[model samples]
Target: MPYSSLPPSAFWKLCRNDRDFLLSDIYQPKFSLTPGMRIATAGSCFAQNIGRYVRASELELVDTEPAPALMPAETAQRFGYGLFSARYGNIYTARQLRQLLEDAVGDRLHDCTLWQRDGRFYDGLRPNTEPEGLGSEDELRAHRLDHLRRVRAIFDTADVFVFTLGLTETWTDTDTGVVFPTAPGVIAGQFDPDRHAFLNLGMGETLEDLSAAITLIRELAPEIRILLTVSPVPLTATASGHHVLRATTYSKSVLRAVAEEVAALDPGIDYFPSYEIITGTPFGARNYKDNLRNVTTEGVQRVMSVFFGAHDGLAPVDRPDTGLARPSSDPDEEDAVVCEEAMLEALAPK
Candidate 1:
């Protein structure tokens, strides 16, 4: 009798029978995201997709490290500009996100975060930003210092902050516990098992790190609203001894639970089900590409449709004329996500 009073959304059979599961009724925005709001996005590669939709819509997506006016769009993307609000490439872990905010405010100064390869230097924190590396350690540090200033500035001006949780497994310096975006050697530095350690964060640690990152975000931007989502893209490779499939599940589980817990604790924070839209069993994985790892354009469109529908009151399904732009036919113009984590695929022995 008590269960009969619940809405259709509360019953699995009712939701399963709906024509489109991603209906606007599924998500009611806690607060509307108007065109006037300044939004900043960061996190794993999937977050790049979120930034793209935000830009396509009337919403203002902040960009602090913009490429030069003359730079070609493709070239700018290759050099890690215009991917997100800042050039902080692929922040793949909650710990890394928290560390970045701390570094922005000079609370934590990490030494030995520089990598050298082929006679050029790279900032280990964001090795992929400069694919060829900088001329010297000084040049790299100067760029990184400037980036920190911009990162701090983004938070100061942002009205809404969107972060996508990507992975629980991260690599950290054994001595300082400072996290690197990628395994050192995979991008630039030489890997030393003794100096570097692989950490698989549990639910407790993931929750703590994300909570702290949110706390820092609010401290810097007192009125900022935080939106959290888990990256639905499967891990490219797993350093853990367990099979990759198992590892991916474990990583996502921890990240998803942390997002839910954090969102529940604060009215300023909200969780978007982008993860479910792409990976949920109900969809039968229709959103993934042939590789079954990369999300298809249609999948991304659906996610954005739901997002815009909730935030901007657009139609959630079959949105032919929504404010969001359609994906370009040319793959080059559409632009593939620049994922440093995918670099690990090179290490696999043929």
Candidate 2:
């Protein structure tokens, strides 16, 4: 009965219900994000939400690869323009992200990771960036080169970098072990079992890959702070042959753990609980659309509100359901979360 009976964080016992507990600020960031800070985001498709949301706020979200001055908004988004700091689309794994920067700085080319469709070539790394295929193999190469140069510039100048970890399962080239965001044929490449292999990364490999990514980013931009979040959206399909439900659990668990390990390495690195905010039991899955995989607009606002609260000296724990945004059944909506992994289902044979 005495106050000495329990340890820290046990205050949840005081809550008569779960919602009160879920709103607590699990994130106390080591770095502050203020207006004019150049925050470049990457990683899973869920990350795309940050750019849209931050632009609507006071923070200075940088777009290193801005669309041509008069480019249409819809057109700009489709060609992988104005999405992240660069044109790189949905970097699903840490190795893919690390290798991207590696290629940018050292010119360690992985050019063979390309796909051909109807006489046009696509960057296997970002097959969907170009809605159609590039005019020629040379065109693909030229665009990729320019993208890399901007990526390097982004890394060198950003005050903060945010990345969302999406999955642990990936398809890679058997000979070279290069990772692909989607299976080859799904978007543009031919899926060949002989040439391509499936890899379901474990905690150790994910940890190592992320460690390398953090190290490389810090080495290039010593003052840049890193923020990492695991996407809460479930996997659309699994090559691991496990039920998507089980696969989702494993994938998220590995990423969440590895993120913590990486964050412990540096004071500037942090892991935000966007994944937990939506997936946590207390929220009761209120954040998902009917499909249960696509996070709703309300959910994105909810997550970002919590994000703003913990950083930038904003109020941290108020859960007023402000109609700050509207919900959508459509993933194509502007400011919608862009999760290319969802394409796996649309690719399934009817």
Candidate 3:
């Protein structure tokens, strides 16, 4: 029988001896990151790993919502930044993120009203926590206006926006078209048909929205480059009708495709194939960590290998002209140990 007409089993058997068939394409590259580069990270929990690994290397990692006095974990929980930074608040889908940027840029502005009080602005949705009961409508509006201004400031200052595309499905306000961080029921809210709707973006729609976001970011800060990745961590749950396992596959496939599409369309935008590096068979059957859901150090190393290799042979980025000498090697090691201890302490039950 001709190869083209052979059944699937026969085809597999014939190619069984091709040792280089799958392995040939799995190359890991080296990445050279400069010190003092201001990079902001957002997306799912897996994306947070980049911040941890980068900061651990003693490079300058930017956190827009830096906590004042709280320890690492407390700062993360209170201000919603770090390790699991929710800087923009649960941007699980590209549509939600795009909508956020659009709103920030004064395009596709939602009807949501904002007001100011006591020198602070608040969105109508986010309430003020004080000894008194819920704040008056005027007070809530003020807080929201202030929040919007702060969010804009973040966009203005960031040099690199490292966005990890997570999911393709989202729940949005039907009338206002405002995308919610979570589904209506999961959070303290109801989704009336007249006011809410669900969106499951296809590959094209995802790319379109992401492209718009990139354009908007450049308008705000033209120097800002975008590094896009697909989160490898599987979904905890899916609103899709399929079983959780199948939904994970569906969601990841869609998001990965979108990342590639957008990267191809723009030069400043780069796609780091972190998803393939971690989940691909080359890593073998072992889970990266004790928490199998999270990618392990070995997995991360593999991703970085490609990152470095891709920029191979280029001169190392020069240290910023600031007269600060590199921190001493021995002291740096000790600081890492201390930081790790502090991380653990911060995470202790409070």
TM-score of each: 0.93, 0.90, 0.68
Over 190-300, each residue of candidate 1 has an lDDT whose tens digit, in order, gives 888989999999999988898889888888999999999899999889989999999999999999999988888888899999998889788887988766788887888
- Best prediction by TM-score: 1
Write candidate 2's Cα lDDT for 115-226 as tens digits.
7889998888888788698888878888888888888889767888999999999998988878888888888889898988899999989888888888888888998899
Cα lDDT listed for each candidate: 0.84, 0.80, 0.56
Candidate numbers, best lDDT first, in rank order: 1, 2, 3
Q: Which RMSD values do the candidates have, in order?
A: 3.4, 3.6, 9.8
Model 1: number of clashes?
0
| Least well predicted 10-residue stretch by lDDT in candidate 3 | 334-343
lDDT for 235 in candidate 2 is 91
Worst 10 residues of 1 by lDDT: 315-324
